[model samples]
Target: MDSGIITILLPLALAIIMVGLGLELTPRDFSRVGKHPKAVLIALFCQLVLLVGIAFVICKVLALPPLLAVGLMLLAASPGGSTANLFSYLFKGDIALNISLTAINSVIAAFTLPLIVNFSIQYFMNDGQQISLQFSKILQVFSIIIVPVCMGMLIRHFAPHLTEKLNKPLRIFAVLFLILIIVGAIIKESHQIMSYITQVGLATVIFCICSLMIGYFVPRLLGINSAQARACAFEIGIHNSTLAMTIALTVMANSAVAMPAAIYSIFMYVFAAIFGTLLNRFSRDDVSSRTTSPT
Candidate 1:
């Protein structure tokens, strides 16, 4: 794709993806959080606080370039996605909980994504980089994320049939667009692509594994059930990389800042699948042992 086409398609594709997300959500998804406040709260803490902190530490420890560091932070800020629910279902997690977390996280990310990305820009890109989200630009970023979501919600509310028809195609488009964006970003920085991957590849893989671990163990340690922990694991682990990439490419207008998310996207699905499989095996073992015991 040409740079001009990518520039136009990036935001447009993101809006379609957000609309697909909204179509999956309803008022009940948000309200469901009240039914499992502890799980919800713990998951959010892991996502918004713990995961972001972990990414920052990885960036600093790995000594990532400024744009890549900002990309990592942006990826950290992106919410969970429908893929989390799918992984949760396959791994015997509480799918309802995954859906609820994804819904609430999407809403929360509209505000937090801008803040985290801006902070990263200030901290990492301050030397001479011309990229920064001013106050007005912050609002623009928020609008780009939140407005389409709200519009989709309204469509789902008022025109459920149409939403149902559009949902699957939009989801397919979302996945395709994500791949194209990642490729575009990589190609844009092809001269430095190898270096970016060298600096970011291990950090992204480690961050993904850590995310799944923290999402599961943190909630489990707090006495949440294993099923719920599995849900949290995928929810916290499988971030909306498409959203992060869109913001980096479209909102920030910086392909360099999109690199981390692009790289992380490549690793996250593979890692999450492995993590979910391990969790499933453990769950089966626990069940088998219990069933065999004289209980």
Candidate 2:
């Protein structure tokens, strides 16, 4: 809640988390995208295009306040993180594909996130608000995201044993940092927390459901196999809310603009678990049907 924490500590925490992400990644993770170009392209389409459109519609239809609308747009723009890879592994999705998508999305988001958030600010904040991700702020976003990742990648490349030692501790820290940020955002906006939730809750829930569905179904319909489709689903479904919140609190310096991501973080894991369970059930049934059919 403090400006000191917002400007300094929050970004430092995020850099550590991004470094953890990089520790998990390697050069191969980026190159692997070439092997599953369809899955990658389809997931990106859903993430960058369809889901962004969906968030805009939800914002307009719900008549969200300007800051909240921009927050939702920011959340929609965030890339999937290491958490998505865990979900993919649990649900029997293509873990390699998840890693590839995460690797690619993180890079692309440095550019796309600023554009989307700036557009949302212009369109939704027609009330003469001065918040915009101008060129310098865009560079800040780029550095916050890419530099730590590159650092982690280099550490892993150069010192394999140190990377291994840092992995678990960083992962734990990332989770703790996320929880702290969400609580801090709520505390900062305590007076308006409930009001903000009432305004943005349904939009976030609907957006989450739509994200999971579109992430999976669109890929499936396009002839991607079930494993890869599940990977696509989780990758698109689980956004890097910490990144959104950090950018909101620090970059835009608005607690209201962080609320959507904070609230969405509460629901995303629950909804993702339920969705993954349903996918597993249906997958088993499909397998049973095939095994039982005349041969």
Candidate 3:
């Protein structure tokens, strides 16, 4: 909540988290996108374009307050993270596809996120607040995201033994840091927490559901297999709340702008689990139907 924390510790924390993300990644992750072109392209479209559009529609339809609207847009712009891969593994999704999507999305988001957030700020908050993501700030966003990731990749490339040893610990640390940021955001807006949730809860919930459905069904409609469809569902559904919140608190210097992400963080896992379970149920039924068919 303090300026010191926002300016100093927030970037440091985000850098550590991004580095942890990188430690799990390698060039193979990026190159794998080429192997699953349909799945990857569909997932990216859902993430970078469709999701942002959905958020904008929700913001307009719900008539969200300026700061909160911008926050929702920020959340929409954030890409999936490691947690998506975990969900994919648990729910019969294509974990490899999830990883490739995440790896590529993270790189693309370093550019797209700034564009979306700046547009949100100008459109949503222009009447009163004057927030601008100028070239310098965009460069800062790029550095904050890409630099640490590159550093971590280099570390893993040069020191395989050390990278292996530190991988789990770094992930643990990143999760802990996310929890702290969410809690801090809640505390900073303690009195307004309930009201904020009341304002944004339904919008986020609908957005999450739509995200999962779009991620899954769109790919399936395009003839992507079930496993890859599942991967797309989770990849598009579970956003990197930590990245969104970090950019809000540090880059935008507004905790109000972090509210949607913090609240969405609480709800996304629950929603994703339910969605995954339902998908598995239908998948089992489909398999049984096929197995029971006449030979």
Cα RMSD (angstroms) for every candidate in the order listed: 1.5, 1.0, 1.3
Best by TM-score: 2
Minimal lDDT window, size 10, model 3: 125-134
Write candidate 2's Cα lDDT for 174-250 as tens digits. Answer: 99999999999999999999999999999999999999999999999999999999999999999999999999999
lDDT of 3 by residue, 1-295 (tens): 8889989998998998888888878899899888899789888988888889999999999999999999999999998967898899999999988888888988899899988988888899865365667788889889988999888889889999999998888889878998999999999999999999999999889898998999999999999999999999999999999988988888788899899999999889999999999998988899999999999
Top lDDT hit: 2
Residue 171, candidate 3: Cα error in Å is: 1.6
TM-score of each: 0.95, 0.98, 0.96
- lDDT, candidate 1, residue 1? 41
lDDT, residue 134, candidate 1? 76
What 10-residue stretch in candidate 1 is worst by lDDT?
1-10
- Model 1: per-residue lDDT, tens digit, 125-196? 875277877778778677777788888889999999999899889878888887888888888899999998
Best-to-worst TM-score order = 2, 3, 1
